[model samples]
Target chain A: MNFNSAAFLVFLPLVVCLYWLLPFRARKYALLMASWFFYMYWNPLLILLLLASTGIDYLCGLGMDRFDGNPGKRKLLLCVSVCMNLGILFFFKYWDFFGECVSGLMAFCGIPYRVPSLNLILPVGISFYTFQTMSYSIDVYRRKCTPEKDFVYFALFVSYFPQLVAGPIERPGDLLPQLKKEHRWRSEDLKAGVRLLLCGFFRKCVVADTCGIYVNRVFDRLLQANALAVAGAGALFCIQMYCDFAGYSEIAAGSARLMGVRLTRNFDRPYLSQSYGEFFRRWHISLNRWFTQYLYIPLGGSRRGLLIRLRNTVIVFALCGLWHGARWTYVLWGLYAAFFVCLESVLEKPAGKITERLNIPLNNPLVIFTRRLYMFLIFIPAALLFRAGSVQEVGQIIQSLLAADFSLTNALGSLGMTSFSIVSLTLTLCAMARIYDFGLYDLPDNGNRTEEAGRQVSGVLMVLVIALCWLALLATEDAAGFAYFQF
Target chain B: MQEWVVLRHPELVLLYGLALLLCLMEKKWKASRGWLFYASCACAAAASAMLILQGADLREAAAYLTVFLLLMPGVRA
Candidate 1:
């Protein structure tokens, strides 16, 4: 069930209440059952996959621990677990995409063979849980986290409903230990939890979904749109995506916080980063760290020669893009990001030399702001690449952008928001979102008592305004599912 | 839509006025911002009742206001 839905609104509180009311030993069992119910609420059959992955990893961890002296056997067990998890993911998520690719290759090669697609429905959150479980087995094999001995606790860690579906993909070391502890109800956690939930819902429904109304319209009739419309919609798509995925992450973390379990932070004001390299460090931090630790470090990372580091960066980004979906567009999107990031890294020395020669002050606020804007604008084409249906569609958008019909009225008119009321509503909502994301009106603190109070009060006012706008938005626009749910 | 008309109706004006007053009081009496939370809730609940009496849909401004208050900052703490 979606976190924004009324059903989950009821379910979360009821589950949390029952969890806290139970004793410590029964609490874990209760939480496990609740998590199973939450997962099964989406699809009853997929719960089996969850159980299978959890069981395999749990057993693998135990086996690795038992054969700790035999490095060969430990390595074999880790590989077994990794292969099993990936095998399930491939069957459920990637089988049809693979078949389609092979079929295309066959047709191009003048072969008379056509590969048939099984067209199996992919289980929701397969990629997320698969990566999470693989991390557990790998960590156990590497002697990082002690193997979880308790079956129920381990199961709870794997199926923790909050971050189970779309995650700030938790590591075993971070989350498993918390599963074993007794949590006491705290008012502070509840307050912070509710704050996060409100912020997430406001962003998802009011900002992202409202923007989706226009973005979907423009993309639906790409041929009818001018350059300005496509580019405007491309920028909105970036905002929509960040809000949608980060919205989900915030809600997940907040829900877990209500149960006194703190998940890792996923986003950190990525839009404010002054460079593409800095953007990666802030955006989807958990996944980036995962790639850095498991993939990049294993491939020698930046510690190696420049050629190896560049190769590793490109390979990791390609895999990262492919991890998002089973489409070539996603791969292209990954390559697009890698290109800019690599360019920035390779040109760092020369760019510094040019700035030195020009006598540009690197720490100037205006310069910093300009750099941030440049970094943000760099993502527009990448966003187009990520969201386009096919390579041809991507070409169409780029061609339209190059044609340069940059009229604002023509763009809004094409999206069916030509009327003053609708246009005002869209712009106002977008402004609120920008302010909310960037904190444009933060109360300045001079360390006085009244100023501190004013700061707190201003924050309270911001949430109130966002909440009011969100409610109004719900009355007008239909809330959309998060964009990341597809992956 | 008629929802916008209902939002601007005379009956809802008092609710907004009350919210404004509570907000000002929150600023004046810095030690007692709790009243703003109550005032926000009471205004929403009363507005919802009025809308119900006027034969309007419950999903109008009242419902929105109620949710806004429930999740409004500084309420739980």
Candidate 2:
């Protein structure tokens, strides 16, 4: 169920209450059952895939531990785990895309081979949980972490409800240990969790959803809109995506916090990053760290020559994009990011010198402003690919943006938006800028008060604002599914 | 089509403009935190109202502004 939905509103509290009420020893089992129920809400059949993966990884972890001294046996266990995790991910996520591509090529060659498509419904959060489970086996094999003896805790670690869907992909080391601890309920933790949930709600329901209306409309009619509209849509898509995904992460982390479990923070103030390298570091930190530790480092990382390091970076990002979806657009998006990262690496020293010579204080208002603008510009094209229905649609949108019809009135008139839209658009921008300015680096410290009094005030205000927004959303009757659910 | 034009909605524009004005004023005035928060809420509500009324193009612009606002702090730092 969607975190924004009324069903989830009821569901979350019920689970949280029951979880706390349960004895410490049974909490993990309680969570595992709740997580399965949560996943089942999407598709009952999908739970089997989860159970299968859980069973495989749990066995693999045990095997790795058992054969710890036998190098050959440990390697075999690792291979089995990799193959099983990747095999499942490939079958569920990429099989259709690969099948279509192969069939299309066969058709072009006049061959009559037609592979029957499975038309499988991708189990919700398969990509996320698979990685979580894989990390457990790999870590155990590498002697980095011990396998959990309790099957239930391991299962819950793989299927924790908060980061289960669209993740700040949790690692076994970070999350597994937390599951073993007795979860104590603290009022401060609950308050902090509630604040985070409300913050996420505002970001998703108010900011992201509202933007989606415009982005979807403009993108849907790409051929008709002018360059301004196309550009506006492209830029808007980036914003919508960040708010939507990050909003979800905030809520997830917040929800977990309410239970006294801390999920890794998914995003820093990513847009504020001066370099593409910095952006990746700040944005989707959990995923980046995961790929770096599990994939990049294993693939020789930067320990090798410069060229190999660059190649590894590209490979990781390309795969990262593919992990997002089966589509080529995601691959292209990955390549687009990889290109910037490689460029940043290549120009790192020179760029540093330039910044020094220009004496651009990193925190100076102008420097910060330019950095944000640059980030927005870089993301526009990447996000265009993300928003497009197909690769061809991306070209059409780009072509529309490059065309010569620059009249503001014609562009705005064609959109046929009401006066209220303009006002909302303007005010939202202003408020967002003010908030961003206040809390970019330290999101939790937006109110700029460390004093208990200030903390209480900010916390209370945030809660009240969120409550009112939730009430408003409920009243509006048009509450929509979160954008990330489709992924 | 003429009736749909948002330029005709003076009251909506005024409410929106007032909300923006209050937000800016809140920053400068250093009033009670509650007052500042209420003003911000009023601005957010007014903006949402404006968004609901406007066409997709204007909504897109609004979204851009909202995103910029959201990220501006991060970008600035």
Candidate 3:
């Protein structure tokens, strides 16, 4: 069930209450069942896949632990778990795209071959849970973390409802230990959880959905849209996506926090980063770290020669894009980001010298503002690459942009919003989002009594505002699923 | 559309009005915020009663769920 869906709204509180009320020893079992039930509520049969992944990884971890002295055997065990999980991910998620590519190549060669598609419904959370379980196996093989002996705890870690579908992608070391502990009721955790839930719902239903209304319309009739409209639509898509996925992450984290389990932070004000390299570091932090650890560093990250580092960067990013979807658009999007990020890495020293000669402090507000706007400008084309239907659609957007029909009225009319409403609503959403995001990084200091009280009161006020807007959005717009769920 | 949006969910509109009115009262009655909260809560309860009296249909029930899940946490805070 989606976090914003009606079913999940009812499901979350009931699970939370049942979790707290259950006896200590039985809580993990109850939570495991609840997590499975949560996944099964989407599609009952697919729960088998989840169980298989969990069971294989659990056995593999145990086997690796048993053969700790035999490095070859441990490696073999890790490979079994990785191959099993990746095989499941591939069959379900990537089979159709891969088949189509092969068929196309054969057709182009003077031979006729067709790889029949299974036309399967890609199971939700396969990508997320696969990586999570593989991490457990890899860490075990690396001797970084012990294999979890408790099947129930390990199982729950794989299929935990909150982050199962869309994730902060918790590691075994971070989440498994918490599963073993007792989580009693705490008012503070509940309040914080509610705050996060409110903020998340606000981001999803209000800001993101509002943007979606406009973005979807423009994309649906791409031919009718001029350059300005497409640009506006692209910017809105970026906002819609960030708020949508980050909102899901916060809600997931908040749901776990209600049970006194904290998931890792995902987005960290990525739009405010001063450089494209910094932006990648801040955005989808868990995924980036995963690639860095498992892929980038393994290929001799920065330790190798410059050419190797660039090659590794490109390969990692290309896979990253493919991870988002099995589409050309997603691959281009990943390549687009890698291009800018690599440029920044190569130009950092030169840019530093220019900044030094310009005699401006890096912390200067105007300089920061310019940097943020530059990054956003860099982001717009990447967003187009991400949301476009095909390479031709992206080309059309760029061609129209070059045509110079940059009329504001055409843009607003195409999206069906007046200047006033969009601006006011955008400002309101951004201000509130900034307030909450700032709190995520730097909470109010407890030592300052009055400031802390003010922070609490402001939080209450923000939640109330978020609730009102969230309700209104539901009353008006069509509620869409979280954008990341497709992956 | 009007009936779907407004006629079926008058209580939601009314309760939201009460919530915003209470927020405005917080500024005017700083020393009596607690009393204002309790009083606003009574109005909200009465608004909910009005909704129940209107009977339960699927669409209206959906509206109620939104208020309960999305809006109530704010009211509680």
Which candidate has the highest TM-score of all? 1
lDDT of 2: 0.74
The DockQ-based CAPRI class assigned to model 2 is: incorrect
Which regions of candidate 1 are displaced past 4 Å?
A418-477, B1-77
Give me the TM-scores for chain A across all models, comma-separated: 0.92, 0.91, 0.94
The residue-level lDDT of candidate 2 at A346 comes to 89
What TM-score would every model get versus the actual structure? 0.86, 0.83, 0.86
Local accuracy by lDDT, each model: 0.77, 0.74, 0.77
The recovered share of true contacts, given per candidate in order, is 0.00, 0.08, 0.00
Candidate 2's residue-wise lDDT over A1-487, tens digit each? 7888777889899989998999987788888888889889988888898899999999888888888789999899899988999999999889989999999999999998876799988777788888888878888988889888888988898889988888878878899888788877898778668767866876777667667767777776779888877777777778778888888998898888889888888888777777788888988888788899989999999989889999999999999898888999999999999999998788888978998999878788887888778977988888888878888997887788778778777566545456666666555545544444222223344554222223343333344434444554455443556656656
Q: After superposition, how far is residue A255 of candidate 2 from its true place, in Å?
A: 0.5
Q: Write one digit per residue (lDDT tens) for candidate 1, span A1-487.
A: 8777778889999998898888888998998998899889888998999999999999999999999899999999999999999999988888888888898899899997777788877788888889999999988887899999999999999899999888888999999888787888898777667757766765676567766777888999998899999988888888888888888888898898888888898988898899998999989998898889889999999877778878888999998998998888999999989988889879998999999999999899999999999998999888888889888998889888888999988898766664543644455454444335322122333454533443344344445445544555566665677777678
DockQ of 1: 0.13
Q: Score the docking of each candidate (DockQ).
A: 0.13, 0.13, 0.08
Clash number for every model?
A: 0, 14, 0
Compose the digit string of candidate 3's lDDT tens values, residues A276-342. Answer: 8899888999989999999999999988877788888899999999999888999999998889878
